[model samples]
Each structure stands twice: as structure tokens, then as C-alpha cells.
Target chain A: MLEALRKISDVVWELPVTHKAGMRVPARIYGTEKLLQEMDEAVFDQISNVATLPGLVKHAICMPDGHFGYGFPIGGVAAMDTEEGVISPGGIGFDINCGMRLLTTNLTAGEVEPYLKSLVDLLFGRVPAGVGSRGSLSLSRTEFRRVLEEGAHWCIENELGRPEDLARTEEHGRIAGADPSLVSEKAIDRGIHQVGTLGSGNHYLEIQAARPADVYDPELARAFGITLPNQVVIMFHCGSRGFGYQVASDYLKVFLKVMEASYGIKILDRELASAPFRSPEGQDYFAAMKCAMNMSFANRQVILHRIREVFADVLGRSAEDLEMHMVYDVAHNTAKLERHLVDGTPRELLVHRKGATRAFGPGAEDLPAAYRETGQPVIIGGSMETGSYLLAGVSSGDQAFFSTAHGSGRTMSRTKARRTWRGRELWREMEERGIYVRTASWAGLAEEAGAAYKDIDEVVEATEMAGISKRVVRFTPLGNIKG
Target chain B: MPYEFLEDVATADIAFEAWGSDLEEAFSAASEATLNVMVEEPGAVRPLETREIHLEAEAVDVLLLDLLQELVYYKDAEQLMLRVDDLEVTGGPPFRLDALARGEHLDPERHRPRVDVKAVTLHRFRVEKTDRGWRASVILDI
Candidate 1:
């Protein structure tokens, strides 16, 4: 009942446009044969479904880490005509603006290794995490609304972070056109007390060891003040918390009813419900979604401030000497207005990257001036046990809408994983391997055991071989705090 | 009928196994199990009135989501507590459903808050039948 896949190249495979009805474009998957075979067949079906959406340009692409997801496979990328296309919540995913951030510190791992446990404890005490977790900072309804609008800029204005930090963040730490009025009351209530909290499941704060001195670019490392083989750095992965969840929830309900009545777009799945870009409902959802994205930027900014305080207090070093500089921040789940080449002609498109990262190549005008020559930094978070990676977008990604993999995709189902491993045993094993972990639930630990995911090295290798992004540095985890 | 709860870090999946000669009974039993994930008491709410609800879905998985979201919408927006009464699923290119839901006014003390069903994820979703009756397995986006 399925068509045979056509091999486009060693690192590329194509599902011809005719494989599915109503397809506007073909589907291209970037990965090696081994990685491709490991993927679930459902991924092809999902990607093909994405291609069938109206006004889809070029191809519907799946990164090496691609896996089965709602409408767009996780790690899927697609560009649509801004004037005539549609936007689906399934394409951006439920966790709007889920992203990663990296910070460099002056202290070497040797200096902090002795007090790593204490540092992890302090961090755990400061940043609230876990399911239904609430933070110490309680915002009045008005202040909460302001945070939804101002984003990380609000954090910097409140002295939580340095103003310069915003320059290194995607979209300068805030996306424009966010309308707080579009956010529902239920969404506002859900996010009011959750600003600085880290909601459970795959969100974490980890301390990692930098790559060997010779492996990193000397000039860039020096500019970023990152040096020494055993340098201690902080990396975290989280999102807009309850705010993003509520935003997606509110819109999905609205879209479900409106899409049928307005556009006559019949989807194969309710999860893929969508509305035309020109519709009022679509514009409102985009604005509200942007507000949630800004809220996440502020959440991570506050967490970074807390990390700085803990480092200064425990190390007895001045904030200046700690030299905690934000290297980069990138979102994994989002749909943005971008310019891309469509059939050799430049056009504006709405690019949807669900569980994928925008890896714009060097000299992109949108990149910060400092990074113009090197390209945007791409942060790929591996499982806590395997550590994470820092990569730079390369020129070849220009042909693929400038996107790359977000992480090592899930390989095993959680049910099978929990049955095979015990939480306590897994915790002890990670500690024995020199990775300290602080978590609120042991059951959660078992579900996220390293064995549950694919090999990050192989996923990254596939991306690199496909000319999407190039690895700059590899980090080994020393300690982690999970929600 | 028996149901088993499966655990995931982000969401929880439960498997409902029921035996019935007809489709309506199996649908009723499965619906009961699905709501059971959110509350401890299924029979505590007095049946004040019965309302007929209809839904059309593209697949069995989406039908399940549409059914659950309808219940959630009633609970949140309309302040109604509901349990499936009579239900039927006619599967085709577009699955059609006819159902009745019974519930009373909200008694806050009787119903305790559980995990929020943020969204119905397509991750690891399955619905199949066994020798006994029918089974539907789903992962809720919590």
C-alpha cells in the first residue's frame, strides 16, 4: 500500500510528490541509510501529510532526528507562502518556543568539581521545577500581562540580566507583534505564578565540560571568554511553561471549529487542524503564540540570573570575575515569517519548525553582526547522560530553509524503557558515571534514562554529512537538575 | 473489563480492555476508563440531565481526542460534569459518532483537580480490538 522510497543521494531520500493526494511538493529526508531505517514508517506518512498542505514551497523536509509526531513529524521543516498558505498548531507543536541556551563561565571544571554537588543543590533550590511546580516570584495580574509582552527585556530592565545578553538571543530575546489581548484569561491564569518555574518532562539544567582547547575556535572562544579543557559551563532546556501550553490549547479549540466553517479544509487528522493565514483567527493565534514565546524568553532569563547568583555566592567570586556570558539561545518549536528561495526565486514564507532548530548559514542578514561571519549558533541537547552539542549553521543549509535537528530523537517508548530500568538504579548509575542529577520524581528519571533516546553523535553526524550544520564543540555533562 | 495505566515522563497512557457483544457497550466502557484518568470518582456526580453529543473525526485516534476535548470543554466552559451514557462509533473514511453524556451541576468539593490535559498528542497513539471487545491506548499531553 506504500510506494518505494527513492534515494536522492547518500544523505538524502525522496518520497515522490505523487505518493500522496493533494501534495503540493515532494518530501525530502536528510539522514544516512542507518538512521533512515531506524525511523518509524509513520514519519514518512506525517511528512507527506505536511506536503499536502496548501501553498507548500519546495519540499517538506525531515531532519535526521525526525520521528513520528502529530501533523509535521518532529524535526520536520516546511515553508509556505505567507499570502496564501495555512498555519497549523500541529506544525509548531504544543510546547511553543521550547528552546536551549548555553552560558560560559570563567571557572574550570577542576575548580568547581569539588563543589559540584553543592552547586547543583543551590541551583535546585533556586529554580523551581517538576510537575505543577510554582515559583517563589508571584506576579500580580498586571505584571504578568507585562511579562507576556516585554519578554526578556523585562528581565533586563528589572536588573535580572545584562542588557548586552539580549543581542545573542534569537530575535533579540523577543518577537515583535505579540498581542497580550489575544491571550485568553485561562492562559493568563495558568502562567501567572509559573514564570520562573521549569515544568516537568525533558526540561533540565546541566553543568558541562567544554571541548578540548585545540578543538574549539581560538578567536571565537577567546571572544566569548571560553577557555580551558575543563571549563565549567551551564546549559539548560525549557520553554514557555504553562503559558505556551495554554496558548496552544486555546487556539486548537478555536481552529477546530473555524477551519471547517471558513476554509473547507478537510484534514486527515483533527490534530492537523488549521486555518488560512489570511483569516482573523489565524492572525490572533500567531499574535498570542508570540506572546507565549516572549514569556519563555523571560523565564529563561530569570533562570540565568538565579544561576549567576548561585555561582557568585558559592564561589565567593564577584559577578564580573565569574564572567558568565550567554553564548546563544535558540528555539525548537515555532513558526516564523522568513525569506527563502522557492524554485530559484526569493519569496516570503511562513516557516514552521516543530522540534527543529533554525540553522541560518553564515552572512545571513538576520543574524547579529558579531555572528554574521560564523552563522547562527545551533544548540542540540542530547540526553543528560550523553551531554549536548554546539553547532554552527553552514552554507549548504541555505538550500534547505536553513534548519537542522533539535536533539537526539526518541528511540524507545517510555513504557518499554521504564519496564527495563528502575529509577533508583538509573540515578545511581549516572552518579557513578560522574554526572550528578537532582530530580523531583524518581519515576520521571526512569522515563528519561539515557537508553530511551538515540545516539546524539550519530544524529549530529547525519546532519553534518547532509551539510546542514557543522559541530563546533561537544560538551560532557557533569551535573544535571531535571523537572 | 480491565485497564492498565502506562507511565511516561511527560504524559500517561492507559489501555482499556473490555468485552461486550455490541459496539455501544464497549464504547461506554472505554469512555468511562478514559475519564477515570482525570478523576477518582465516576459515579459521584448526580445525573441531572442527559445531553446528546455528536462528533465526526478523520480517524479513531482523532475521534478519541474529539470525545475527550468535548468533555473537557463542557467541564471548563459550561461548568458541567459528565460521564458517557450511550455511545456508538461508525468507522469509515470519516468516523462518525453518536453519544449521550450525563452530568450534574459542579460540586467543587466532590471533584478534585487532576493533571491538565494540555493537548492530545499524536505520540504513541493506538486503538485496536482484542478477542474480548475493544482497546484504545493514548498518551495525553499533560
Candidate 2:
């Protein structure tokens, strides 16, 4: 892989446009030599394929946590000219708007340590998880459509979360232009009962604490609500569930049939199925995708409400007394219309981020007043055994289209991880280390062993060095509920 | 091989290929392999309730994908872990599949659920006829 890549800087590599004939732009990768070596060679192939797509501006890029994926590398970030460029469901991935949310509390680890086990059990019971786990609330067809259109705002309207949560979420927890008519009935059927549920494999809700020693930028950490060591927080990872999957699957078929036959477009991989962003088919897909994105926000919002209720029950205090306020929520997978400076002139581009986080710099008008001076809060999750990080978007991030690595990307396959460790044993080990864990499937836990993923510290270091995003605080897990 | 898991097809997802003497046998084995990924055993599912599935796609590989996704829909929407009871495939530029599946609503004690396959991705998806009869390969996003 190194033989085909040209080192552009200490932490950047480039794949020349000459590598592929139809390529419209070069491909750039951010990583250290060691981290680059750890990446699968297929990532280069996938990213290069992405570069060949129509109207791709600047370059096809990948973050330090880059890994092999179907059409686009998991950590890929690309921007396309709205008029000529295309939109691909594979680029956004199956789990539309799969993202992370962090909630800050006044409580500390010491104050909650004694009840950590019970907290874990309570949270595990409250948040529906595992395969086929239906959410506590069942939505009728009409109510479900409202969720698709309203996003987290639906949760707020239903009294699941405070209005403040909407302020801190990406796109204010709701993206406009969702058309329920564009979404298929099968997609709605799959999503109706799955709201507020955590789907299996790599999805989790964790209780974490930030130690003083783990603080990276003290002032920034404080601004983001991290006050002192062991400050308690709750974080969860999930997506649109089966609704998003069906939407992507349903559209890939449309793009595959229309791209070549109607638009005369050609692609190297079928998984990269796409349509011009301005075409009728593309607009229809974008509309349907917004519905899935909104549904996901609503799903996480409902889960947040559940967490608050569980805490109140276990701690014997009102949620207000606990001060369980949301810090921020960010999506890792999405395609959005944004205006960015290209060659010193602003251009409207559809930015696609797959396994990448949007890290808009400070003073961006879209940010709430509290974050306007501090920049968007980027929540990066790690494995259950490893610690996670809270980073703030930096002005320097415009170099990579304002995107950064989403998480510690997987390094090993599920089969390999399961073969190396037993889930039952790992659960016991985590418990011994003071991290309580409740899982629906033990074998599923083995598939997510920390060893299966790239080291978070190294990935974050490379991200910072590449001028994408800067760290604010580091958080270690206290207890977790894994699906 | 009747059916076997494939390593290295994807980084985090699972992939497998199923073979058969005919298309029906191959499709049945593929469906079984997918269910087996979620539960300890596919044989453990009794034929208590039966659900019918019909799929139409532009290509043969897509026919397989639609079929798998149908089964996944049942698992997520209805909480049913099904085993393919019967299957049939026929026709042209537009391919079609008719299948019957049997299973029961998941019971944690009995199913010992392993993982939920979120979707059948087009990554490395293929369907081909070999000297041994027929084969299909799929990579599932979990």
C-alpha cells in the first residue's frame, strides 16, 4: 500500500490522480506511518474509487481511523458540487445518522461509585437493546411519521427532553425537507417499533467520567461542561435502525438501475451506486434520507429520556436535582448541504461523512450561543474497555472539509476477536477493573473487545496533528450497557 | 462445502458463501447461514409459524439481497428468527423469488441470540454458478 501512496507531509499521504483513469481528483489520507501501516490496503482502493465520482471537489479524503468499507472507506470525507456531483447511499452507510450524544451531570464518580452496578443494571433494563428488542413506546403509523419529520424535536414536544438539548444537537436535532411520502412502507414498518431501542453490534450506552489528569485543554473542557476529575456523564451510540437500512437498500436499487441506463454514468463498484444530486431520483433519495435522519434523532432522544428516568429511580432524586443536561449530539454518518470556502470563494457542496464527524470551527452561525465561541463539541466514542474523548472543532479543520475521525476504527474482524477471547471472561475482567457491564449477548461483547479496534490515543493524536480537531477532555468508562 | 463463513471479506461485518446442487438448495442454505449468525442453531427453530416472502429485483445478486433483507425485516419487525422452509426462483432481466419461512418469536433462553444482522450490504456480494452447481456470497452489515 505504501508503494502506491506518496507522503505529502508528516501526517498526510496522497494518491495521485494517475492511479485511476476516470479519477477527477486526487485522494488524501491523514495518518502516521505506523497507523497507516495498520490500515487495510483496501481502504486506498475504496477511497480512490470515490475520487472518480462526478463533481468531487478538492480531493477524496480519509481520517486516521480509516478502514475498508464497501464503496467509501469508513473514515472517508468528500465534498461534491451540488449541480454536477452525485449522492450515493453507500457513502452515507446503512445506519443513517448513526451518531453519538454526551450528557453532563453534576454528580461525580465518587458520589455514584457505590451504586454503579445497580445503575448499569437499571440502564440496561430501561434502554431496549439487542436483536428484535422493541422500544417501550409503540408508535402508530401517524405518530411514527411525525417522528420521521420532527427528529429530536418530536422528543422535546412529547416532553422526553428539554428544549436545551435541541440547541446543542447537530442541525438542531432536526433537518428540514423530510417527505414521509417518499419513504417506503416497508422502511416505516421496520422502524415503527424500534424507536428508543439500541440495535446490536458496536452500539452502546456508557456511563463515563473525566479525570483531571485526562483533561487536554482545561478551559475548553470546562466550557464544554467538564469541571473536574471523575465528573459523571452519560453517552450513547445508535442510529435510525431498520428504517434507515431499508431506505438505503431501497434506494441503492434505484440508483443502480438509473445511473447507467439513464444518466450514462459508470462506476467501479456496484455498492457505490449513485445519482446526480440535482436529478429527480437524487432529490427523492435525499428527502427520504432526511426522514431516516430525523427518525434516528428521535430514537436517541427517547433513549435519553429513558436514561434520565432510570437515574431518578436508582439515585432517588429528581432529574433536575441530578442536573443531567445534554452537552451535545453529533452525527458521524450523513450528507449535508453546506457552503464552504473553496479557493477563497464560497461554494455550496454536499459533504458526505462516513465514520467521520463534522467539526465546524468556532463562530459558525449555526452553533448555539454557548458553543459559538467554543466551536462544536465533537464526541468521540471508544471501546468499552478503553477511554473516549471530547474534542472541540478548531479553525484549522477547514483543510479537510471540517471533518475528523469518528471513533477508534476497527482493526480486527469479528471472527478473529471472538476466536481470541471469550465474552464471559472479558465481562468478568471489566467488572474486576470497576467497570460494570450489562450485555444482552455475551458473544456480541467478544466481537467488540478493545483489541479489535485501533488505539484511541494514537488516532486522536494523528487527528490533532493533521489539524482536523483538537482534544478537550478524555473520559474513561465507569459502567456500560452493550447491545 | 454446504455453507461456511468467510474471513477477511470485510473488516467489521460478516461474510459467507453457501453452495447447493440447485438454486433452491443454495438459497435455502444462504438463508440458514444468515439466521445461524444470530442464534446458536438454526435447527433449534421449530416450524410453528410460517411466513411467505416474495421479492423482485433487476438482477440475480439483488434477488438474493432482497430475499435476505426480507428475512432480516421479519427478525427486527416481528421478532421472528426464521429458517427457510421452501424457496423458488425464475425468470429474466427482472428476477423474482418466492419463499416460505418458519420460526417462532425469539425467546432468550431458547434462541441464545448471537447477533442481529442489520442489512445485507452490496459489499463483495455475488451470485454465480460453479462446476459444483451454484453459489452465493454475501457480506452482512451488523
Candidate 3:
């Protein structure tokens, strides 16, 4: 697989269409030479498989953080012609709209350091975590229907958040066209008690600080709402929980049953089960998918409410007094309709980004007025021991349909990480380095050891070099609540 | 051990292979491995409740996938952590399986929550008859 890659540039490699049979287009990979050499061989196979799917425009692209996933490689990007393309649940992960949210604070690390432990402890107690964790708000089947339609508006109207928060969120915290009638009873049952809960297996809420030294573009940093040196901030990663999973599971079976018979499409991987974009089954999944998307937006909005309450109570100050305003919220897993130039022709494409974040450049439509001049703020989370990054989109990002790397993708498998380190010991080591940590399970923490992931600096740098996104600021961990 | 977790099969998810003297035992072992991924101690879960399961699939592999998905569904809908107490498997164009699941709602105190498995994936999912008996390989999304 490595030998088959032809270097396109310093950071781009091409897997020619002739390399695989039935490939509609070639596969392109973005990464440094060193990063490419270390990539798993399975990544090549998976990306190549994605290239064979019908209605793909241009090439199948994999970002710097790429790794082999179930059907599509993680950090992958593909744009399909909406009028003639297909929609696959495998393209968008089971965790529909699993995304990241970041907020800026007027308070400095110095002010929060005194009570960091208290803040984290309170957050752990206030926001539910781990398997089968339930939140404070319990909704009925009927109320959940409203949540699927209104998204974050439901939370704000319920007094869980401020209205301005919607402005900083993608799609304004709500994805429309959700046919609640299409959502199943099983999915609603799973969603009823799971809102506002931080689920396990890589989901986390961490308190971090940005020092002036870590700011790469000071001008862009301030534009994105980082005003002071040693400033404190909040960033959390989660998804729609079980409601989204059930939706994807339900559709996977539906597509499998009809894909070969009704659509006459054959896939290399069964997980890649898909239906034509205009097919009855496909449109039904889209409407049902919007429900899960809105549910996740509401889920994160409620979690934000819990965080604000904990900070205010712990610091003996009003949330307003602390100036905890949101920076941006970006979804890494989703399929959306967008207009992009394909071979010099403007076309509407259904972009599927799994483990990839949309990094639309400055002046792109749908961006809030405040971000029109600075492009979209992209949040890239690192492992607990390592730091996370903030980047912004550039016009050059159009090379890959305005998509960028999602995170510091894992290098070692969970089994290897568990065999190498004890979670209890890793917790002690992080504390020694000034990162206060709290988690529901120690064994689970071991699986996310910093050493288990690729170097975040290298991953972020490769994206910038590829001109997909540019770095703005780096954040160091101060405290964490691992679900 | 009837089952063992495998490395290199999946990078970001969990994968395991299980075996037994026959098809029923192979399915049972796969259930235990799946439970172990969510809880630190399987034995700690006492049989505080029982739920009946009846499913029919066109193939053996689909049968195993559907059965495992039932466990994931109950975890979210009712917060239950169920274990297969006993099961009966019959082969045909439409394979049939009936089982009694016994466990309790997830109690963080006893179950010792590890990772919440979101769903089971068809990526490399398989069931095969071996010289000794049967084996099943499964991958889970987290």
C-alpha cells in the first residue's frame, strides 16, 4: 500500500484510480512523509474502498489524522452528488453529530487554579457520566419529539442556556427537516434519560488555559475571543448518545435489506450498506438523521448549562460576572448539503465527514457575521496528558471541500495501551504534571493514555502545511472530567 | 476463558473472538466478552432481574449480531446490564434463538462501568464451524 502512493506534494499523496478496480476516482491522503510511513496499511484499503462508491465527486480524501475505521477511514472526507449519490450510515458514524464545543472565559488560570479540584468535582457530580448515565431532566416520548424538532432552542426555551449561544453553533444549534414521525419508539426511549450526560469511551470535558507563548497567530487568536494571556477556557467532546446509535443501527439494517435488491448497488463492505440519495429509504434516513442531530445539539446545550452552574457556584460569582461566552461548536461526524466547485462546475454535494471537521474559509455562507472575516474556528482535541489546538479555515481549504483533521488520532490500539500502563498510575502521573483528573473508571482511562495517540503537534502541523486549516492557539490541560 | 480480546483488528473500537464446544456455547461466550467490555467485573452483576429474548435471523452471523444488539438496546432504554443465563439455538433457513437474560440495571457501584458500547458493527463480523466446535468474531462501536 505504501509503495502504491505517488507523492503529490510535500504533504499530499495520491493513490491513483488505476490502483483499485471499480474506483470512480483516485484517493488522496494529506500528511507529512513521516506520518504517511507510519500509517496502518488498512487505511489504504478502506480509503480505496470509499473511492469505489458511486457519485463521488473529485477524489476520496483522508486527512492527516487518518486511521482505519469500520467502513470509511476515520478523518475521511467524501462529497457525493446529491441528485445521483447514495447515503450510507457507515459514512456518518453511529454517534451522529458527535462534536466539540469550546467557550472563552474572562477569568485567568490563576483565579480558577485555587479551586480547580472543587470545580471538577462539582462538574462530575452535576453532569452524569459513563454507561447508562442519566441526566436531571426526564422527558416523555411527546416532549422528546419537540427536542428532535427544536434542538438547542428547546434547551434555551427551557431556560438551560442563553439565546446568543445559538449564534456560535453550527446550523444555529438546530438541523431542520427532522420528521419526528420517522423516528422510532426505541430511539425515543433511549433518548429520554440520556440528555446532558457525558458518555464513556473518549468523551470528556476538560478545563484548559491558553498562555501567550502558545498563541501561534496572536491577531487571529484575539479574533476568536482569546483576549488575555493565561486565560481559562472550557472545551467538551460528546455526541447524541444512545438515541443516535439506535437511529444508525435501524437504518443500517434497512439499507442492507434494500441496497442490493432495490438499488442494484454492490458494496465491498457490508458496513457500507447504502441507498440512492433520492430513494425513499435514503430520504427517510435523512429525516430521521436530523432528529438525532438535533438531539445531540440539545444534549451539548444542556451540558453547557450544567458547566455554567458549577463554575458560578464554585467561584461564588454569577456566570455573567465570569464572562463565559462560547467561542464555537463544530460537528465532526455528519452529512450535509453544500455547494462546492467540482471540476470548475458548481454542484450541490452531500458531504460526508466522519472524524473530519468542516473548516469553511472566511466569507463562507452560514458562518456567523463575527467569523466572516476570520473563517470558522476549528477545535482539535488531544489526549488528556497532551494539549489540544484551535485552528481556523483558509481559502485553500477548498482543496478538500473545506474539511480538516478532527483530533490527535490514536496510534496504538486500546488493548496495547491497557497492556502497557495502569490507569491508576497514569492518573497519578497526570496529577504530578498539574492536571487534576476525575473519572468513572480507571481501566477506561488507561486506554486513553497520551502515549497511545499520535503527536498532536505533528497532526496539526500537517493540516496547516496541506493548507486545509491554520493553527491559532494551543491549550494546556488544567483539569479534566473523563466519562 | 471462552473468549479473548484481539488487537490490530480494530484501532478505535473493541473486537473479540469467542469459541465453545457447539454453536450455542459459542454464542454464549461472545455475550460474556461483550459484557466484559462495559463492566470491569462480570461476576459482580447479580441476577436481580430476568428478561426473555426470542429472535429469528436468516443466517447464523446475523443471529449473533442481532442478539448482541439487544443487549446494547436494553442498556440505553432501561439502564439494564443483562447477561445470557441460558439460550437455545436451532439451525434453518431462518435460524432461531430463545434465551433468558438475567441481570440488574447498571449500578455504577457494582458493575464498575468501563466503556459504553454504542452498537455492534458488521465490520469483520463472522461465525464459523471449527473442527472442535464453533467460533464467532465480533467488533463493537463505542
Candidate 4:
């Protein structure tokens, strides 16, 4: 049974607290009417279930890309009082800190067009990808622990990147409170050889072009070094590699037991198993989770170093001349301690963004000084065949705990996509469109075909119109490396 | 009874599903199937070492996730390819479990991963009973 949606605005709809049992707050969804109609009813049910969790503050929000996920919708956002609320693994997702990083180069598409294939090959050789892929850098147990705690800072210390790179990253590349001891030996072993690797699925490294229509503001483009039509840029998406995976696996076992004994909270979905934020188990998981976040940060930083190396080798130019500066790095799957306005009063909350992005508006104190005026750059990745987007945070995101959509959101099942599309044909099509693709598995490639997801442009438009975030620029893919 | 492998990806209706009569049997079958989803053969895994595993979950599905994660942990960290020998699950707010898993050193020819399951997800997860026996379905966070 479904309840009538209460319209908050043309783009906002609310599921009242009365819609479900044990609901501590309402559930709000931001989407256009067309997009809302496309969503399954279960997405609403999951959002309602999230609202029912104890100590939830404000509303459980779903961005325009919202779709049915584990306990919470994929594009779900929820903030809970850190002192009294709960933390669920489902809210943080499996790939901890699975995020996007944008790199801006001084070269235009015309300058790189002749050497696109060579550049793609160099990048493919440098970045190890695909399922169960291992990287060139292998760390011992001691070094692995240090990497977990220091994140990108560790890479910078090792001369993999410059000091300036840390300031442009979220949380300055290291999340505090990470305890390496909490990580299990098994987790440590799994992650030792996986740093700088791009593990399979939707993760990718891409070269893109910014067209004139894609550029929202000319001045903004000029400032960001994205001035010319068909300017070349790089955007890569990945996470803490195997390290994050192992951390989540180890902690979920602990949390499952803690939820049962401590809270007596019975959830219909096993994936929604959770614990009170104040509990010892909760603290332990948070600490270990932060370690995973840091590990991923280091992984991305190392990959960026590899990218820089490949560019220098192929272009025959100094790294400085390439101007491969990081535009921004933002996490899509994470839970962060944040302060937000709830009912016009400031409250400390543990904000969980599963398949969502933190879209902090302009003048946010947390933002780096260089980006404070432009707000957080929300990199929304689409499939390899389609285009990705860059969006700026809007003030209205404060109502949703400063959250927005992460990606295009899957509309078709992987099985269906694989059955309908052929990898070879898809690869040829992308090649015809001047997009080079390097993939490990044909079946995996078929599963990630662009047709399997909703239109990214439509999804971003809905988010912008809903006031959750505003579009900044579009980057059309020129080449992609997928695992 | 003979066992058969089922190929259900983490998706809408056709997720990773398994069936058996009792809790141990249901869990064992599900564990075997989950490993099969990652690799080609679970039966080919010889019992090289035996490990004791005790886990707790809020429900049957959570219990399944814990169970599967343990196997993944063993496979990835220890380089052991495992198959569940026994599984017993008790239900409550905090469910308890006792399990035995056995695996040999990784044999590349026998065990090649189809996909790396980053983690097990609670999204659209369900474990219930049908007229024939018990059944469970879960979406892996890949």
C-alpha cells in the first residue's frame, strides 16, 4: 500500500511521518514530476523506513537520482544527532568514500586530438584497472597502516603529489579519528597490494571535452582553466580500493550484533542493521571507516600521480606546463560529522550520503578558500559512453543537509543490460564517437552500457530545477578506462 | 539431494537467492551459491584448513551478510578458497551463529573471480520461507 505524496513544492514531495511505524521524522524527495513517476514505489518505502530510525533529525531526503537501494535509497541523505541518533552501514554504502576527482589541463581538445589514442594507451598502461586488479605499488603491513592514517598526505610525503593537492581535497585528504588497529589482519592483507588500482564496475578514468553549450559561464570557465571549446580535461572515479571493502566487511559483523543487544531495533532488511551513534560499536566502526576514507584518498592521490607521469612521458612536456591541477575531489559514498540547521536551529549531526554528494553552498566555512566563492564542485559521473557533469551547490541544499545526486542512477538491471547489449558493438559505437574504452571484461562492459542508466542530463536538470544543486558545466567523454 | 548453481546478479528481482530446509542447510546453500557467484567452482575447493567462525546478526539476512563477508575475508586476506562445511543460525534481536568453513590455498585454475564484491549490501535484501523450504536473497555492494 502507498500513501498519497504531500507536495511541498513543484519539485519537492513529502511522505509524512504517519506513513510508517516508528517514524521519527518525515521523508522528503526532490525530483521533477516526470522523474518521480519513473521511480519505483519501493524507493519511497525505503526512505520512509530510514525516517523510522530512532533520533533522525530533519527529513530523510532522496535526490533526483534516487532509486531503490539497500535499506536506504541510492541517492538518500539523512542526518542524525551524533549524541542520540543511529549509524547504519547501508547509509554509507559498501565502497567507502567512492568519489570523483576532476583534473583541469591547459590543452584544448584540438591540441590533444591528434594524440588522443596515444594518451589513452599511456593512461591505460599506467593505471591498473578491472576486477580484482592489483597495482604496481605494493606496501608492507607497516606502510599500509601509515597509508590508512595519513591518506593523500602520505602520498604527498612520499612525493607522489605536491602539498597544494591536499588543500583542494575534501577534509584536506585525511579524515581524523582513523584507528588502524581496529582494522582486521584480513583487511590489511587485502589492501596491501591494491593501492592505486581502479577496481571494477562503474569506476573509471576518463578524458573529456567541454563544449560551448556545456559551459554555463564564460568567466567561470576562464578562471577554472576550462576556457576553449573542446578543451581537454580528466575525470576519474574510484574509491579506497580493497581497503575500504575489507573495513566495511569487518565492521558490519560487529554492528549487526550491537544493534540486536543494544537497541533492540528490529529492521525488516538485514542491510539496514544499525547501532546508536553513541555506542562503543558505533565509535569503533566510525574510526575504522575513517581509516578506509583515508586509504581511498591515498589511492586516488597515487592514481593522480600516475596520471601526471603518463602525461609528462607522452606529451614531452614538464608536469607544470601541463597544468594538470585538481579542480576538486568529492566523496559520493560516506558518512561525515557535520553541522546543519534543523528547524532553523544549528545542530550537530552525523550525515550519511550513500549514493549522494555533499553539495555545500557558497560561503561554507568547510570549503577550501579557493572554492568558497563557487561553492563545492559536485562531480556527477555518468556511464563511460555518456557524459559526466559538474554542478555547484545551491543554498536550498541546506534543507536536505547540503546533499545532491551522485550519478545518473541505474534504471535497468545488469543482467538485462548484458542480455540486450553486446560489449563489442558498444565499444565500436563509442570508438565511432571518438571515445576510446579500455575494459577488462566484455560482459562487465555490456552491463555498464549507457542505455542501462537514466539520462544524466535529465537527472542533473531535475536536481538544478529542484534547487538541490545547479549545473556548472558538462564534460563529454573522449576516452574511458573501466574495470 | 543434488545441488544446483543459480546465477542471480545483485539486481531488481533476480538477486543472489538460495534455498534449503533448515537454518544450517539454508545458510550453507546460500554461502556456497555466493562463492559460486564470484568463482566457477566451490566443490573443487579441497579442505586444506579448517577455521571456526562465530557471528551474530539482527536477522536472517544480516546473518547471511556476516556469513558471506567472513568467507570473502578468508578468500581475500588468507588467500584461501572456502566452502561452508556447516552453519547454524539462531534468530532474535541479536541473532547468533556458529559456522565451519574449509578451504585450500588459492588454485588459480579453479578459482577466478568474475567480479570483486566490494561488500555485501542490505539494499532490497530478503530471507524468507516458501512452501518447499527456506529462501534468501541479497544484493551485493559491488
> Over 4 Å off in model 1, which ranges?
A1-3, A213-225, B5-118, B122-137
Against the unseen true structure, what C-alpha lDDT does each candidate score? 0.78, 0.90, 0.91, 0.81
State residue A364's C-alpha deviation in candidate 2, in Å.
0.9
Ranking by lDDT: 3, 2, 4, 1
Interface C-alpha RMSD, model 4: 3.7
- Tell me the tens digit of each residue's lDDT in model 4 across A144-233: 899999999999999999888898899999999999999888788788877898877778899999988899866656655677778888
Candidate 3's residue-wise lDDT over A1-483, tens digit each? 778999999999999999989899999999998888767887888899999898999999998998878778888899999977899888888999999999988989998999999999999999898887899998988899999999999999999999999999999999989888987898888888998999988899999999889999999999998989999999999999999999999999999999999889989999889999999999999999989999999999999999999999999898888888889989998999899987788889999999999999999988999999999999999998899999999999999999999998888887778889998999999999999999988878998899888889999999999999999999999999998
| Pairs that clash in candidate 3 | none
Q: After superposition, how far is residue B29 of candidate 1 from its true place, in Å?
A: 8.5
Q: Evaluate residue A446 in candidate 4 and report its C-alpha lDDT on the 0 to 100 scale.
A: 79
Worst lDDT 10-window in candidate 1 chain A = A214-223
Q: What would the DockQ be for model 1?
A: 0.14
Over A1-483, each residue of candidate 1 has an lDDT whose tens digit, in order, gives 123678887888888888888777899988888888878776888898888888788899999888867778888898888877888888998789989999998888888888899999999989987644567677888888888889999889888899878998898888999999999886776677777776666788999988684244555554444667777889998888767876887788789888988888877776677888779988999999999899999988888888899989888997678889898889999999998876678889999999899999888988888788887888899998997888888889976799999998877655556578887799899999999998865656776788788788888888888899987777899999987
Specify the poorest-scoring 10-residue window by lDDT in model 4 chain B. Answer: B5-14
Candidate that scores best on DockQ: 3
Recovered native contacts, candidate 4: 0.35
DockQ ranking from best candidate downward: 3, 2, 4, 1
Give the clashing pairs for model 4: A70-B123, A271-B122
DockQ for each of the predicted structures, in order? 0.14, 0.78, 0.84, 0.32
lDDT string for model 1 (B26-141, tens) is 55655665555444465677788677889887776567667765665455334466788768889765989889899865553564322333455545556666676566665566
Best by lDDT: 3
